[model samples]
Target: MPGLGEIIRESQIWKSIFRHPMPLDRRNRIVVMLTNFFLHLHPVSIKKQGIALSYTWCMGGVTFFLFLVETVTGVLLMFYYRPTVEWAYTDIQMLRDVHSLGILREIHRWGAHAMVITVWLHMYRVFLTGSYKPPREFNWVIGVFLLLLTLLLSFTGYLLPWDQLAVWAITVGSNMARATPILGHEGPGQQLLTLGGVDMITNASDARFALLGAREVGEETLNRFYILHCIAIPLAVALLLAIHFWRVRKDGGISGPL
Candidate 1:
């Protein structure tokens, strides 16, 4: 006779969802991993040494966990947020006061900074162990991109509060783009853009202008940054993160000694 576990596995709901029994055996284990969405990020087997707390420091896993925290808190914060300049600061204030959702914002903000630190530490550990070699080379490149995206996610988010500090900070940060070689008004080689007595790369069309959406920071800048922080950049980062996780699994799990 079938065991109780087998009988439960045969139930309609279990069969429809799991389509397999608990991973009690090697084949079932592999099948369960391959079929599940979350489990697929992990290999069916990993180097035992790689999982040691001292060796790996668990930095990568911690970074991913913090990302999950930020994503969830960010979504919750969005429910009370308005991207418009008129309502932007007011909304954050409301979160702090009326809705008492300030903790969510605090968690999201600090978690972002913490994510940056953990990602750096994770890369450092990988480097120390020479894990960037051979089959992991492409994955290292993906990590580099993910690091950049993490910084960008932080940068775009800095402007969302729409306060004087946020505005001025982003203004100064955006102004640095004006020195981007030919693309910026004050950048090197900009002298070459005197074609037909018209400066092809003037302040009107320079990087800073494009970033702020005007000559100075204002509603448009806030709106643009909000879209980028809340939607575009996060979506891009999530896609890159998925690719990073998949690449980790494909490269034979976490790297360790050969």
Candidate 2:
């Protein structure tokens, strides 16, 4: 037993593999306490009954479960999707036309809708519970941003089908971007485009250009939207999502009454 102990104690490989501190050691506490990046992310201990099933369940764990489900199903959908306009609409149609396509699409669509609802409810719960005071205020801001990103993600993806609804919805959604003020990207960029002799600045470079991938809503536009829908927006969302979770841990794992 002593020989075994020595081997375990001296094993650098073991230390590297098991980086987490020993569960109850005071020495481990000091190590965690001194680590800046992770130090403030967790309390030293928790009450035995603090995380009761009722308290935890009342919040939105189900919503997070839906997010994971969407992630898995989305990845599967990726395999069947191509970003080109020619293929994008077709792929979506195929999802419906094929035997299981209907099931997959509904699960993905409904899952997205449910995720939005659940996230909102989650924030509401946190607010009602008075969890956004002081140290957690910054995290609350981050959560709000995440909620917006989630909605944007849904909106941006809506146009992939190239159907009447998708086209019109994005057509309207993007028009709002056009009307935003100079600092909002309309005034300054628009004036610059006009000076450059781009007759239809909308055709040359604008919200439509960015969204459609070309001057107008043709093949190129769909392709661009597909890229944003599948890749760019998701990456941005994921990065912010990481920060959101990290801030939660840092802010003492949700606030309580002072």
Candidate 3:
């Protein structure tokens, strides 16, 4: 009689799901790698040095892990927090005091900070390892974009608290957009671009207005940042991350040596 393992492998349910037997042989291994969705994200084989903890530092993995943590905790926080001026600050307080869910906010906050640090370190390690050369150049560009998205995610989330620090910080930060060349009212090229001899860029219509959805940071800014932090930026980051990982696999797995 066949063994228990063999019996399970031959079952219809197993065959339907896995579509392959145990990867005991090279052909089976190849088939398994290609057929599995998660496995396909990685190479069939990676160099020993590429996976070494000392060399890789596992920063990429840590960063991705923290992103997952943030996603989970952020969703939990959203159930309690409101995006309006009246309830936003009170909701945060409720999470901390009333519901005792303060740990979730703390975890999400620290995870965001950790993710930023890990992404920078990951890029630094890639540069030091010469991983951005030749075939990996395009992926490096993707990484740079991902880094920007990470920062944007953090910035947008900063205003959700609806506190003095959050409001003023966003005010100072958004003011910088007013200095954006050509697009900003106070920017260098604003005077040159005129519609019927009238300056097009103004305080009412400039990059700052576009960012805040108003002349200043208030209700509109709070709602806009809430949507961006919880929806827009995260979706964009997810898309870029998918491309980044695919490129890593296409560029011959993790970079190892020269």
lDDT of each: 0.87, 0.70, 0.91
lDDT string, candidate 2, 1-258, tens digits: 469866886689867755655536887776665554645544556654446654444445576577677777888887887767678778888888974755777798898888888888888877877778888898888888878877877887687667888888888777666654432235454554445574345444555456556644567767776677677877877787778778877777745544
Which of the two, 1 or 3, has more TM-score? Answer: 1
TM-score of each: 0.90, 0.71, 0.88
Better of 1 and 3 by lDDT: 3
Between candidates 1 and 2, the one scoring higher on TM-score is 1
The CA lDDT at 96 in model 1 is 84
Model 1 bad stretches (over 4 Å) = 1-10, 23-31
Which runs in model 3 stand beyond 4 Å of their true positions? 1-32
- RMSD after CA superposition, every candidate: 2.7, 6.0, 2.7
Q: Least lDDT summed over 10 consecutive residues: which range in candidate 3?
A: 249-258
Error of 2 at 236 (Å): 2.0
Error of 2 at 96 (Å): 2.3
Model 2, C-alpha of 131: deviation from truth (Å) = 1.4
The top-ranked prediction according to lDDT is 3
Clashes of each: 0, 1, 0
Error of 3 at 87 (Å): 0.9
